[model samples]
Target: MIPIRDTAPCYSRPLATWGLIVVCVIIFVWLQFLPFEVSNPLIARFGMVPLRYSDPSWAEHVGLPFDGYLSFLTSLFLHGNWFHLIINMWFLWIFGDNIEDRMGHLSFLAFYLLCGLIATALQWYFDPRLEIPVVGASGPIAGVLAAYFFLYPLERVVLWVPPIVVHVPAIAFLGLWVIIQLYEATTSILFEGGVAKMAWWAHLGGFIAGFLLYRLFLKKPPDGIKMEDSSSFKI
Candidate 1:
């Protein structure tokens, strides 16, 4: 399903969310202007490569930088193509604003990076020797989706499900997504030798991290407001 919007209202401006979107777009556009040879090498240098950490000998042989560990964080801002960038940014736009509104800007940004890091770590643990560069914002965006799922469980998500646009409870929408990601992650590990082009493990890991960690980052509710009460949510 393609998510259009959610029923949850944001009292504060999504400054951090907008800032992240702008940064990703600017980086993508700049990379597009560079030649494939140049851009590809840059991505390889900065994008998360599991093998670079799994085998230092091979990493040295391939001349991957010693500080390649930074890729865990840096790769979040990189994208392989326009579709990847657009879809990730769209997910962020859909889910991130409310998360930022709930956690406040800096806390949301920190939570995002922490989730991305944990997601990267999980992917690396599962496919330690895979020699592929994983780039894009999907991991952190998955985290955002998980946060939205918990914080607004009963909130309705407006989606275009083929011929009709319908509203579904956030749990139903995000639960389906979680199930799909779990299935894909399992299939990839068993049948694909844990080497699917898409990083399903990272997606699952990010969601898990966010699910377990979001409450810690959430801001205290004002006065009589309850944080998890969906009855007061806006449609």
Candidate 2:
């Protein structure tokens, strides 16, 4: 299902959400302007490479500090293409504001980064030997979806059920999404050596992290306040 929007009105502006989107846009623009291969070599030097923590050749060659911890954060800002960047940012835009409203700006930012780090750690744990550079905000955005599902499960969401467009409860859409991720992860494991490059495990990892972390970080709304339906507007 393609979720168009939620019905709830955000209590706060979600400054951090906008800020993150802006930062992602700027990074995406910068990446587009540069030669694709110019950063290809650098990605190997700086991007997280699962398990094998070998010395970075580019770091040594360029006399730069190649810290793994730093890469955990930097990888979120990098993407493979315009589509990758747009979809990630779009997810953040749609679901992030409500999450930010619940956690507040600063706390939401911390929660986001924390989830991203944990998601990366999980991915690395699963495939430490792989040398492919992991990049994108999908992991963290998946966390946001997890948190959203818990905080407002009943909120109505407008979605297109391929060939049929309709509205459904947020929980229903997100729940199905999680199931799909689990199925993909299982298939990836069972059907070894597939050409599919999507990181289903990362989504699973981030979803789990978001589910657990929301309990700790989400703030209960004030009494008498009600969340709105997310699919009130027609696209």
Candidate 3:
């Protein structure tokens, strides 16, 4: 199912969310200008390699001495293709504004990076020997979805079911989304090459991190609704 928009209302403008979208777009555009084929050594330099701690030759040539840790954050801004970049950024634009409003600017930014890092770590943990580069904002955006689920369970999300349509609660939609990820994750473990490209574990890890960390960073409504009780407020 594709999400069109959410019905939740925000009291504050999401400037930070727009800024993040712009940054991601610019980085993706820059990456497009570079050679992206697997044969190109440049891919290894900018991409996140799960097992290796050493810096790629391109990074060293460019005067970046750090290993893939920095790439964990940087890789989020890169994409393998137009479809990859569009889908990831689309979700980010859809859900990020509400999350930014709830967590404020700086806090949301830190939370986003932290979620991405944890998501990368989770993927690394599962596929330590895999050398394929994982890139995209889906993992961090999954984190935002988790926080949104927790903060606004009753909020309505308009979903486009191909040619059909349905309105579902954000909690239900995101819940099913996570379930799909879990199914893929488990199937991938049970059947070799069940899913070739997706990082299901990263989504799981980001969701868990967001669900937990949201408690500490979530802003209380100006009306003094308890965080736990704020779900009762409907749009």
Top model by TM-score, which number?
1
- Write model 3 residue lDDT over 79-175, tens digit each, in one string: 7778887888888888888888878988898888888889878887887666667777877888898899888888889999989888998889989
In terms of lDDT, the best-performing candidate is 1
**Regions more than 4 Å wrong, model 3:** 35-40, 54-68, 193-195, 220-229
Q: Estimate each model's TM-score.
A: 0.94, 0.85, 0.87
The number of residue pairs in model 1 that clash at the backbone is 0
* Lowest summed lDDT window (length 10), candidate 1: 226-235
Candidate 2 C-alpha lDDT tens digits along 149-172: 877787877886889879787888
Better structure of 1 and 2 per TM-score: 1
